[model samples]
Target chain A: MGIEFQNVNKTYPDGTVAVDQFSLHVPSHTSTVLLGSSGCGKTTLLRMVNRMVDPSSGAVLIDDEDVAGVEPVALRRRIGYVMQNSGLLPHRRVIDNIATVSRLNGVAKAAAHRRAHELMETVGLDSALAQRYPGQLSGGQQQRVGVARGLAADPNILLMDEPFGAVDPLVRLELQRELTRIQSELHKTIIFVTHDIDEALTLGDQIVVLKKGGEVAQIGTPQQIVESPADDFVAQFLGLDSARRTLSAAPRDDGGWFVSDAQGRPLGVVDSLPQHPGQNA
Target chain B: MAWILDHLPRILELSLAHLLLAAPAIAAAFLVAVPIAWAANRVRPLREIVVSGTGLLYAVPSLPLFIVLPIILGTGVRDTLNVIVALTIFGLALMVRSAADALDSVDGGVRLASTAVGYSAALRFFTVELPLAGPALLAGLRVVSVSTISLVSVSAVLGVQSLGSLFTDGFERGIVPSIVAGIAFTAVLALLLDLLLVAAGRLTMPWVKGGRR
Candidate 1:
């Protein structure tokens, strides 16, 4: 299901405006990433969908239905939420953790466990790990269980708040790939929150680059944002002006061309040139 | 040693009486403290009031509490019921605070996750929060158990019959062995109760065993 945020505003009692006048349309069956650094209110915007944080003003709607009309608990049960640090219960075994929402929804014990075993496999976790507590698993394995638990309820919308932020880069890459594969098979409307530009680029079909107070710096495909940033803040946040993002190509002795960063660090080699050089011209 | 052998049956009787007094108070304190601790955990102002207010109950001298409870409860000073009630009050004083701290030790992330996964507040408390707080709660109960066992001896000052009578009689008769024996048996009882708590913790909280994490 698609989600819409209409002029949402969130202000803390202490007078901090966490989100202000934010509006967006998250298309169904697509991954929409809200990308920004900390304190940018990206997470606050994502949480508004499930009513984890009710807006101080404006409304959040799911499939043209205003979420305010729905009970928060009922609304949340149908929305899958995955957070950073895995957040798996320390005292619960992996199977029970995965079966948590299913059981809460009143699925019988044997059926819930059966579905939990299936979800474990869906998330690429070994069935052998099902009986172990979350503490006994590795960080990546625990995150796999977190993903499994998120998918256990089989909700239409999945909210991920930096779901892979705590793992090592290699594990994060693997998890990202796994999520992409899962999204391909199951086209849930996914609202992903992250600070990493590369992660947003890799996973998001539509990326919403946010500024402080959840201000929209840019909203476009990753290519559009990379090729033309909306403003200096978007450019700087994406490191477009930095050497890390700027690449230089040098002709290699072989037929391939060597691509390197501005600092002469090798990025990779392009095997073949465009069929027609300067085709735009 | 000779006196203990001669009065072995008497010592056994007193020990049984002592167990009877301590066990019910300890159990009642635990049952009472859990709900109060849960209430205290829910609100900030209430936490301060409940924890500190109950804590003051410990400062009421046991002999006076034993003596005063008769008038309040309409029981005689020497009634076993009066001592048990007094000890329950004392146990609550320690237990309420420990239970609150135990609940506080549960991970905030886990609590949030539990709610996000659709657990109702009451179900979350019983299933997730309470079980997660088990180890610390068990630790607190161990302290309350040992202290309650030792504190039962204080009832003897009110003319109630318990193993503590051995101390009073030994002092009157100038028999050091009787006093030493009473102390030994009290320590041994505390040790046995502590071990039982540990065993119960092991049985119920399997996740805490096997050096996991």
Candidate 2:
């Protein structure tokens, strides 16, 4: 596992349990999403990995090593974190914002700027925006800059807390697609938190459905989750008809492809498949 | 009219000296107050102590401060040190308070963003926190400069002779035009100082103006 929570529990000073004995594993080089409504403790769980908020009890491990042992600031640098609002420093230009982590680690000023420039290109932002401050950028553009900044330090893991939540729907979709592309190319272990089910289905390699008070309602791939929900909560949480949605995963290939039953064994050709010449229907 | 004509050259010379006196006093007060304010803002314990101490210092009449300084720092505490000390104490409390408020009001998100990006406490304060707090700090400084000009005439009571000294002379001699000239010069200087502050604020805090637009 790239990151794992071992019996972690957190109760606020007011005696409200934000997260209960939560334990889960995120596989290396894959995106594991924490999907829930507000107050589900998804955000609280994400913050524990970097020790921004310490767990009341239990351990957070990165590659089986306890994150508690590492200095919070040092641990944070090794893990990229993106908040809902993008959280760009208004006083810093695009290039400087991207270079913030590198500069903090004492990278030569010129080298940091160069790295920022390169990352800006990688994220598909115009290099010309490099000199502009955060206030000058659009919401989508700011989020792009935030992603580039997160990746600038080249951390092995990235944590996102409703990263696209603040943007309008159109911009939100664009950023989500961009993030998916970044994940595919980089293959960093990612923990994405979102309230939107569509966002979870689209982004998660493995989805962790969190119940209120931080219990794991369910954990599985999209197909496994929809097809074989762990409990009534999962069914209700994901809404009804999840099984049909899971079954719809098979691609609509022509008679070149055939449908199969639960087993890998082929049953029959799909009549709904698009027709192809020189092939048996 | 003949007497006024004869004294014009001396009046100009004295006026120049008074300008000289007020300018450095204001500059020195700002120099001392800004860092104190910045420091007070950075350290919590110091903030209350420094602000309260400067407040107490400000309440001590400027005439007594000037008079007592020569006795404590030794007699002949004329020119720069005397004027600077008076203005520095006079303005310090307000500057520190302003700076602390400004720093406190800095957007919480900016600080969090800086921390998440791995910026050290010092780097974040200097680059992000301080810049964002620029408008408030400048406003504080404007208050300090204006206060300095108004309080500077108190030095005239020590016979140090600035614009206030002219007022003192006019009051003692009961000459109406001299009092008029003193008030006129001081008012004009206050207005000019205020304008310069606004201009400086504009230049340094473009983000504020840009945000408003």
Off-target runs (Cα >4 Å) in candidate 1 are A275-281, B210-213
Best by lDDT: 1
Displacement of the residue B108 alpha carbon in candidate 2, Å: 0.8
lDDT value, residue A64 of candidate 2: 85
Candidate 2 wrongly placed segments (more than 4 Å) = A241-281, B1-61, B68-80
Compared with the real two-chain complex, what DockQ does model 2 have?
0.37
lDDT (tens digit, per residue) of candidate 1 on A132-205: 98889988998999988889889999999999999999999999999999999999999999999999999999
What proportion of the true contacts does each candidate reproduce?
A: 0.57, 0.45
Fnat, model 1, is 0.57
The DockQ score of candidate 1 comes to 0.66
lDDT of 1 at A236: 97
How much is A51 displaced in model 2, in angstroms?
2.3
In candidate 2, position A152 carries an lDDT of 88
Tens-place lDDT digits, model 1, residues B45-141: 8899999999999999888888889999999998988889999999999999999999999999888887777777888899989998999988889
Error of 2 at B31 (Å): 5.9
What does candidate 2's lDDT look like per residue over A1-281, in tens digits? Answer: 58999999999999999998999999999999999999999999999988878999999999989988998777778788888778988767789889888887778999999999999988889998887877888888888998998898998999898989989999888888988888889999999999988788889999999999998888999888877889988887777444323332155545344565444555556556555887888
